[model samples]
Target: MTEIKRPTWAISNPLMQQYYDTQWGIELHDERALFEMLCLETYQAGLSWQTVLNKRSAFEDAFHHYEIEQVAQMTETQIAPQLKNEKIIRNRLKLNATVNNARTIVKLHVAGRTFDDYIWQFVDYQPQRLVIQKDENLPAQTRLSVQVSKQMKKDGFKFVGPVTIYSYLLAVGVVNARLD
Candidate 1:
C-alpha cells in the first residue's frame, strides 16, 4: 500500500490536511458558507491560508458562526472586542469589512438574491473547472476574476480586489484547482 502525501501547503497539520482534502476546490452552493469564505478570504489578505485556516474556529465563534443575518446586523463596536482576542486575525479593516460584507449579503437577500446567486452569476452559475499542468503557473488574477471583482466593487463590496476575488473564487469552487 502507498500513502498519498498532500502538498506542503495542504498538509502542515491535521486541520489543513482535512480542509484541503475534503473542502478545497469543492463546489460550495450554500449561501452562508460562501459568505463565510468571502470574509475569511478578506482576512487572508497578505497572509497565508494556513494562518486563516488555523483560526477558522475562533473566527466562526467571533462571527457568530457566520450567520448571515446575525453578522449582517453587527455594529463596529460590537465587533471591536474581537480585536483584543488573540484567537483570530485582529486587523481592524478586515474585521470591519467582514461585518460590512455581511450587510451586503443581507442586502442582496433583500433584493431577492443570495450571495451564492450573485457570485455564480460571474461564471454563468457554473464552476469553471481547469486542468492544472503546473501549479506554479496558475495566474494570480484572471479575466473572470477581474470582471467579477469590478462588479462586486461597483455593487459595494470591500476588500474585494482582483487578487482577493480570484482567491475567493477558487475557495468557493467557482474555479476548480486541479494542480499537478
Candidate 2:
C-alpha cells in the first residue's frame, strides 16, 4: 500500500482528494460553477468542508444543479422539501438563503452583471497567488475576504460572512497557493 501525496486537508478522504485533485484551488471562470461554490461555502458554515463535499451531489440535485435562474425561481414550496431531505444540510435558514443568494445572482445578471464579474473585480481580474508554506498556518479570514464579503453583503448576497468568503476564495482559486 502507498500513501498518496495530498494536501493536509485532503488526507484519508477519497472525496476530498478527488475534490482537491479535480476541483479545489483550480482557477474557475464559469459563472455557474462559481455560483455553486459560493452557495456550498455558505452551507459549510459551522461545518467541516468534508461534510459539505460529501453532500455536494445532494445539494446540486436539491438546488437544481445550482443553476442561478432555476434556483432563483425556487420558492418556499420548492425549498421546503429540501429542509427535510436527509442527504443535504437540513438548516432551513441556510437553505432559504441559498435560494435568496441565487435570486441575488439573478438580479445581478438582470442588471448586466454576472457573479463572476462582481467577484473578479476585487482582485483586478487576477488570481491572488498565496505563498503558504503550511496550510495549517493560513488565517481563517483575510483582509481581502473581509472586503469582498462586505461588498457582497451590500449587494444582497446572504451567508457570505468573511470566513466563508475566504474559503470560497480559496476553493475557486481567487486565492491560490503558490505551487513552487
Candidate 3:
C-alpha cells in the first residue's frame, strides 16, 4: 500500500498546523465543546494560535476539562497556581478572563440558553462559507463578529473582542472558510 500526503493550511508555526488539521473549522454542536473552544479562543487574544495549540492539553487539565460549572465556581486562589504553570500561557489577565467567562457561561445556562444558541443566532444558525485561496486573505474580524462581540461583552463575557470572537466563529464552524 502507498501512503498519501494530506493537504493542510500553512500557518506561522507547526502547532498552528496541528490545530488546523485537528480542530479548526470543524462543526461542533455540543455545549461543553463549544465552551472549551470559546475559552481557548479568548486566551488566544494577543497571541498566536500556535501558542494556544501547544498548551491545549495543559489548559484542558488546568481548567478541569472546561467544565462550565466547575470553572465558574473557581476562585482567584484556585487560578493563581496556573499563572506559574509552564504548560499553558502564563498571562494572569487571560487566566482571569477565562474564569470570568466561565461564570457568564453558567449564567447563560441558567437563563435556559446555551452559548451555542446565542452565538449561532447571530448567523441564523448557518456557517458563513468563504472562498479563500490563501490564508493571508482570511480576515481578522468582520461585521458579524463585531456585533457578536458587543453582545457577548454586554452579557458579561470577558476577552471577547471582535478579533477573538471572529477566531472563535471560524474555529467552531460558524464561519467556514473552505476553498470550493
Candidate 4:
C-alpha cells in the first residue's frame, strides 16, 4: 500500500488531508455549500481549520444543513441551545452570526440574486489562481479580501473580516491559493 503525500497543513489530520485532496479549492457552485463554508470559516475565525473540519457534521446538523432559507429563519430562541453544544465550536457570537449571515443571504435571494452570483462577481465570475513561491509568500489577507470583507460588512454580513473572508474565498474556489 502507498501513502498519499499531502501539504503540511493537512498531513496532521485525516479530515484535513481528505478536505485538501478532494474538497479544498474545488469550485463550489451550490448556494447551500457556499453558505456552509462561509459559516464554517466564521466559526474558525479564532481557531484552526482542523477544529472546524472535525465538527463540520455537528454544525450541519445544528444549522439545518446550511440551507439558506431554513437557516435564515433561525431565531435567537432557536440558536440559544447551540451555544451549549459540546460537539461544535459553541461560540455564541459565531452562532448568532451564522443566523445573521443566513438572513443576509436570504436578502440577496429576495433581490433576485443567488449567493453564488453575488460572491463570484467580486472576481468577475472567474476563479483566480495565485503564484506562490513559498509558504512565507502566502498571504493571510489580500487587498481583494479586504475589499470583499468591507462590502460584505456593508451588506449586513457579520463575522466577515478580511482574514476570514480570505479563507472563505479560498474555500469557495473564488480564489485558488493552492501551492504548486
Question: Which pairs, if any, clash in model 3?
Answer: none
- What lDDT would each prediction earn against the true structure? 0.87, 0.88, 0.83, 0.89
TM-scores of the candidates in the order shown: 0.92, 0.94, 0.89, 0.93
Give the TM-score comparing model 3 with the true structure, all chains together: 0.89
Q: Which structure among the candidates has the greatest lDDT?
A: 4
Model 4 lDDT vs. the true structure?
0.89
lDDT string, candidate 1, 59-148, tens digits:
999999999999988987888799999999999989988888888888898999888889998889889987764334667899999999
- Candidate 3 lDDT over residue span 1-180, tens digit each: 543222344355676666666677777688889999998988788876777777889999999999889999999899999999999998888899888988998898899998889889998988888656653467889999999999999999888999999989988989987444
RMSD of each: 2.1, 2.5, 2.8, 2.2
Q: In model 4, how large is the Cα lDDT of residue 122?
A: 96
**Between 2 and 4, whose lDDT is larger?**
4
Better of 1 and 4 by TM-score: 4
lDDT of 2 by residue, 1-180 (tens): 544345577765778878877787788889999999998999999999889988999999999898889999998998888878999999987998898998998898899998888888999989999876644467889999999999999989888999999999999999986344
- Candidate 4, residues 34-113: lDDT per residue as tens digits? 99999999999989888899899999999999988999999888998888899999989899999999999999989999
User: Model 2, clash count?
Assistant: 0
